[model samples]
Target: MTSMKRVLKLCLGSARGAMVQGGALTVLVLLAGVGLLALSGWFITAAAAAGLAGAGLAFEVFRPSAGVRALALGRTGARYGERLLTHDATLKALVAVRLRLLRGLMSQPLRRLERARAGAALNRLIADVDALDGVTLRLFLPAVAGALTLLVSVIGLAVLVSGTVALWIGAVYGIGALGIGLRFGPQALPVARRAERALQAVRARTNDAFAARADLTVYNALDRQIAHAGHAATELAKARAHRDGIERAAQFWVTATVQLAVAGALGLGFMAVTNGALSAPLAMTGVLAALALSEALMPLARGISEFGRIADSARRVMGDIPETVPELHPRHDAKPMVVPPLDLRSVAIRPLIDTLSLTVEAGEMALLAGPSGVGKTTVLNVIAGLLPPDRGKVCIGGTPLTDHAEEDLRGRLGFVPQRTTVMDGTLMDSLRLGNATLTEAEAWHLLDIVQMAGFAKSRDGLQTRLGSRGNALSGGERRRVALARAIAGRPPVLLMDEPTEGLDEATATAVLKGIRAYLPKSAILIASHRACDRVLATRVITLR
Candidate 1:
């Protein structure tokens, strides 16, 4: 609950002023709506009674009718303004929350980040964020409006009608509204939360089925995926149906409260009229006011029932976020430096590569040849500052990686992970990602160094559009493009994992030479299985 409050505060703080104005307007809107209903009821009842009593000309209709019109217009305008302010502000707050949530997720260590970023967890993160809309827009503002409307309506009744009318109507209406909330909220909350989860499950399952369609089809297991998705959908339908039933029941209770309170007001008003203590018209006003006030408080009941869903979303989002976010990425104020030696000292990430120290200086290519699962990629990840080594320090230019921010420290190095990822964009955009200022001519030069100039020309030159993950290009082309992108910045240190994996022996040897020729002073580290990679290296470090 404390964490949920914190998350809500963060969202509300994003647009505090607008949210405040929206809330105030919410109260005004509901009050105006009640005033409109009550006034209209009084005008109709009083005019009809005066005509029956042969005194139609004695009753003034203009002022009351004018007041009704004014209240009606005011309510409409206020309602519009309230919607605009609250929704706009909430949208801005949602954007802020989304960025903060991603920043929080990104702060996790690489291993944890990978785990948390699996299809289902990431989908849940997004769903939870979307659900936060219910927090301020549904629960908070409406609750405030409902409570204020009830209080103001009670005071108005006392002044306009009679103290007795005010007392009984207020008691009945307040207790009934609160009772409806208390009755439905607790039972509906967990049910609503379960419904929300079930809905997300449907979405996640559907996405997985489509994503793994090929594998599922190959194994003749597509039906299983469909079954899982269908089961989630069924659960979602049941939960929502239950919530709908609860909401409908609440409406029944609200209507019943309105009638009971109205009946009491009618009883009190008739007695007052019989004794000549109150006019018949104002008596109708009191009864109608009770009806309007009861209806006005209905939003509170719905908001209360929705609290479960909102709290669950806030809790999940807040819980997933780490309080202490490490300053892994460099701040803009951080100073950049030239790349230094890739240094490791007795660095270890248990179960493999234990108690090892190594250094690759500037202008050297040190090949790490090792059997699979010997932590070659792990070493690259450590050097890339993605993974924190369990045992020892990894330093750059005599500065510890932890002390240095990523953009400040690793900004001086180029790292290509084993799995290639290219954003959907043109070839020029891909090349310019590493060095924003890279020119068309410079891009072609790097392409030539990696022997990809022909590949670029065969397509659209620099304008060739790459598909998702650069799937438009072949495996070898993607690798070369990744290599070209990394060296585009010409960092003094370069790390590549199985970089030459798909290329043939001759192309692989040339690509390696081209990278060295392109960055003459760069310190390069290659983790690979190919013999050609070891032959061209300045040194080879083998792992058992």
Candidate 2:
């Protein structure tokens, strides 16, 4: 909750003036609506009274009619401007907050980010951040505007009508509004939160069902996966329906309360008119104002219903982020070492590889060849600084691994893991992740090197959108895409775990040749047991 408050403070503090102006406009729009109704009622009642008293011609209609017209037009314009400013400001704030959250997630170690980037972590990106977007519009602004409008209308009634009438009407509204909130606010919160959880489950379950479709089919469990997904969907639907029911029930109470207040005010207005303490027009003004106040109270119903989910989402999201995020790239004054391009000294990861040492210098290709479970990928991780070795030092260009900043390591080194997956973006977007300023010509050149230029051009060229995990492309094409990405900038040190795993001998040889031609000075290391890969290795170090 404190985190949610901080996020709101950040949002409003950043755009205080615009949000304030929008809130004021919201108040004006609602106030004008109330005033318009009251004045219109008074005009009709007074004009009729003047006719009965045989002085209708002497009564002024132009000014009252013109005032009504102005209020109506002004309310419409103010409403439009209010919506535009507030929504625009909220959207801009959402962008900044999302970026902040993304940066926060990236601030974690690469291991965690790698593990969480797919299903659940993605919710933080699309669903969770979006859940809090309505905080200002649905809750804060409407709440302030609603309270102000109600107060101002009650005060107006006191001045323009009987004080006793104003007192009773205000009491009825104030009590009713409080009663409704107190009654449903707590009850609706938990239900709304459950709905949001169910929604997340639906997303995760649906992704799981599709992602493991092959395994499920082979195991004769596809029906069970489908059932799981269907159950999650059903749960989400039920939760949403429950939340809507709560909202509608609250609306019912709000309407009944408003009607009750209007009726009492109308009864009091008749009595006041009979006693001659207030004119018919003035009595009608109070009655109509009481009725118009309903609009101001309407927002409270929605605010109550959404209160739990938005606040929870905000708290959880913001709570994960610290008040200050340290610099992602801490500058290093250390110069590059004149040693091998890749070096590891006495590295150990328990039984995986004890006291292992190796180096791959510039323009050399070192293949780590071993049988399965020989800690092949784990050694690559240590070289990439992804997993710190238990007892040894890893260095890049003579600089200790810990000394290099994230940006520096990424800039100087490239590693393609055994299990590669594509991000949800275009082919160009994936390529640009490696080199942000990469152009179409360069992208095509790299694709041509990987023998994927025809595949890309066959679809939508560089702009072709790949589905989740590159489902849009074949497995071989996806592997090639990862190869192209890893070597996009032609980094000085390249690490590959089965880069040519699925490719035939002919294509693998050509791809390997392209990599060498593109980066002749680079130190390339491969973790492969394939004979085809062993053919071109300048040196092969077989792990025991």
Candidate 3:
């Protein structure tokens, strides 16, 4: 709860001016509404009494009529302004939250990010971020606006009517609002929170179902996945219905409490009239004020009911962020280490790569050979700086790898992992990973080297849109595209993990031939368990 408050404070602090302005407008809108209703009731009663006394023409009706018009216009205009400012502030806060979330994720270790992708983390992240808007729009603003209306209405009644009568009215209305909060607020909170989780579950399952549609169909389990999504949706709907029922009941109780208060006021007004202590017009005004105050207080119950879920969402969003994020500003003084004989001196990774020492000199193609569990890929990761060595050091050009920033190292090394990662974008977009500024001509040249130029040009040229995870292309095609992307910038030291794993024999031979011809002067290290990879290597390092 404390953390939730902290997050709310941070959000409010980001757009304090707009929030405060919107809050002030809301107060004005509520006050205008109450004033309009009270004035209308008093005017009608006063007009009726004057007519009964045969003094209808002598009464001053124009002033009250004009006041009513002014209040109506003011309330409408203020309500519109409040919505505009509040929504604008919310949009700004949304942008801030997204930026912070991206920064937090980027600061985490590569392994953590990789693990997070296998679950529903992305769906939940989006849901939690959007839920924050409700906190500002529904909860905080409405609660504050309702309280202000109550306070001002009570004070006005006390001045217009008798103090004793005002006290009774305040007690009834205040107690009714407080009771609604105490009785239903806590109950609806947990239910609303459960609904949020249920909804997230439904969203996650739906996304998974779509992403794995082909596999599910092939395995004859498409119906099973669809059933799972349906079940999650049913649970979410049930939870929402329960939470809403509690809110409606609370609203009904508030309505009844206000009616009872109005009845009591009418009785008191009759006694005052009989005793010649209060005017009929003023008594009517007091009753109308109670009704207006009830309307203002109604939304408060809904806001309180929603408070718990938004708080829960806030907690989930901030839960994974480190206490302090690493600074991501580009380092002006850092540059990629030039020259190479990529060297790992006595490197040891827990349960893998035990006390390994190796060197891949410039212009040489080195192969990492081992059986299935010998950490061939792990060594490549360590050299690529994705995994920190438990002992010993990795150096390039006699400079320790750790001495260079991660961004700087990215330019000096080209690493293609075992898994293919191709997001939904145009062909040019995916091919520019190694170099953002690469021109279409240069990208096509690289694709031609990997024998994908004809394929890309025949489709949409540089504008070919790939589906999510490059699902539009086959396994071999995706692998070749990834290779083209990695070499687009002509990285001096290449690290590939089973680059030919998914390709046919002829395609794999052409890929190796292209690499040798295009990058003859660059050092290359390939991690593979395939015996066929040995023929292309200048030297093979066989792990025991």
Clashes of each: 0, 0, 0
- lDDT tens per residue, model 3, 1-544: 6656656676797899999999999899988988999899999999999999999999998999999999999999999999999999988887777677777776667778778854456744576788788777887788788787778878888888877667877888778878877887778668877887788778788989998999999999999999999998999999988977887887788779989888888888878888999999998888888777776777766766676677777777777655565676656676556877788899998887669888889899999998888888888888988888999999887778988776667887898999868889988999887789999778888888888888887899889988988999888888888888888777788999999887777778778778878888788999986656678889999987
lDDT of 2 by residue, 63-100 (tens): 99999999999999999999988887788778877888
> After best superposition, candidate 2 residue 444: deviation in angstroms?
4.3
Question: What is residue 103's positional error in candidate 1, in angstroms?
Answer: 0.7
Q: What is the lDDT of residue 37 in candidate 1?
A: 83
Positional deviation of residue 427's Cα in model 2 after best superposition, in angstroms: 4.7
lDDT of 1 by residue, 31-106 (tens): 8977988899889988999899999999998999999999999999999999999998888888877777777877
**lDDT at 495, model 2:** 94
Clashing pairs in 2: none
Deviation in angstroms for 541 in model 1? 1.6
Q: What's model 1's TM-score?
A: 0.90
Off by over 4 Å in 3: 109-111, 117-119, 160-162, 165-175, 193-234, 264-274, 331-341, 396-402, 513-523, 531-533
In order, what lDDT does every prediction score?
0.84, 0.85, 0.82
* Candidate achieving higher lDDT, 2 or 3: 2
Query: How big is the positional error of residue 271 in model 2, measured in Å on the Cα after superposition?
Result: 4.8
Q: How are the candidates ranked when ordered by TM-score, highest leading? A: 1, 3, 2
